[model samples]
Target: MVGMTEINVREFRDYAAGLAQQAASLILTKRAEITATDDIRSHSQTKTSAVDPVTEVDTAAEAFIVDSIHRDRPDDGIIGEEGADIPSKSGVSWVIDPIDGTVNFMYGLGEYAVSIGAMVDGQYVAGVVINVVKQTLYSAAVGHGATVTYRDGTSTILRCRQETDPQLSLIATGFGYTQTRRSGQAKILQEVLPQVRDIRRMGSAALDMCRVAEGTVDAYYEHGVKIWDVAAGIVIAREAGAQVRVPEVWEKNSARGTLVWAASAELAPAFERLLSSVGANGEID
Candidate 1:
């Protein structure tokens, strides 16, 4: 990991955003082809759990991203959800999630994204997430504000809502793939569901965090999200005025990380307290 001082924020931000946009384009093209095919699941397979699906498009997207990064930034390490891991030689690394909501993409739910985050010495410096179906782009760089570009080509600065009242907070969350972890997640959700305005199970964590950034959701919390799932969106959320908190000790390989995001600084503590009250701040045990 390289120190933060060594990174060129704007340059890397542009690069990451471009990579994400290109990857999103690739994903959308593949999605179209898959939708036209009769056997959509023919090239799909289960991973880790029978419910955890991986499609050919996911692998192809990751390959394109990894190859692009290797050619453009050979010294930078790459870690991707589709099994691309290269050691860093330049103190920089890119985290990639080819398709954040594969299930949603497969079922034509229009809730998936391609997420890319650049980090220096394990600290995020730039990030980008593109909603493939919606054609929306969310991006951020450290010390710079977050912004969202719409399908119409107009862009707007992003900001989280200022609502501090927990009951009025429209929280977004997600479930795990395995039955055991999902059962534990259910127990936690049961305690917190009635206390908020409502709960939305958005199929994509990356997009959910982006929703927090854009004030579409007041807060978001989820357990067992891999780093690739939230790395890019978390930066956008934080830069957009949302306060985000993750586990003190992060282990990318462990499917037990907990992430919490609140719309504003004042609401973060209140949200954290609510999460603790419901025992949602810890691992799904």
Candidate 2:
């Protein structure tokens, strides 16, 4: 009983990594099949808004991940972007984003990914993010650190870049689908862009966070991303020594326009001060 409740972080990390890879493979195959014979848009639909799209592959991949988790970890709960909800009796839960960049995947941009995370008592302990197009995998077990496996099959431990100067930092960011949120984000970026070295807007939130973890990007911040969009990434970034800020796991309303940011430990303080000066600390209202 106590052993089962202990929730082994390594075991959870392994589970998340395996499931993310399998789901990424499923997404790639299905995406190819969909595009080979028909217009990608025909297989997708809008959810929160006309711009907020979800594709058939997204649903299919999520179903595959949910079923796999249910079969392997029966007592664990699940919360997925495609509406998978399962209650956990084992005090462990999975947050799933089957395809983190649906629009990029639909457009063949090659920046989308599959993200999976395990949380215990509202705290993330293990996570995996598999970049479908990049053929890379990122995984982390709490207190054990994080690692990224490259397309060439080489793997390396993850770490945030060491930069104390905010003006020289390369930042990554994303925007919301709604015009109101977009308008608000534009204002935020106006203030943020001049303070950083430059800003890169990659369509995928999960990948942006992973970039911060892997030192490819000095920092990342955005508004309106949900738990599924950044759960795996939050763990990966934090384990890689990035300072992370986010709303509670249960705070699922992206419409509220909350802020999420991750920066290297060396730069986090100055970055926070910069954000405060620019008024990026609260919701986008």
The candidate maximizing TM-score is 2
- The digit string of per-residue lDDT tens for model 2 on 1-285 reads 113233498888988888888888888888788888999989999998898899989999999999998999899899999999887888889999999999999889989999998888778888899999888999998888999998898999999999999899999999888888899899989998988899999899999999999999999999878999999999999999999999864565446788899999999999989999998888874
CA lDDT of 39 in candidate 1? Answer: 62
Query: How does candidate 2 score on lDDT?
Result: 0.89
The TM-score measured for candidate 2 stands at 0.96
Give the range where candidate 1 is weakest over 10 consecutive residues by summed lDDT: 255-264
What value of lDDT does candidate 1 attain over all alpha carbons? Answer: 0.86
**How good is model 1 by TM-score?**
0.95
> Backbone clashes in each candidate structure, one number apiece?
1, 0
* Per-prediction TM-score to the true structure, in the order listed: 0.95, 0.96
Q: Residues 179-221, candidate 1, lDDT per residue (tens digit)?
A: 8888988988899888999999879989998999999989988
Hey, what RMSD does candidate 2 come out at?
Answer: 1.6
RMSD of each: 1.6, 1.6
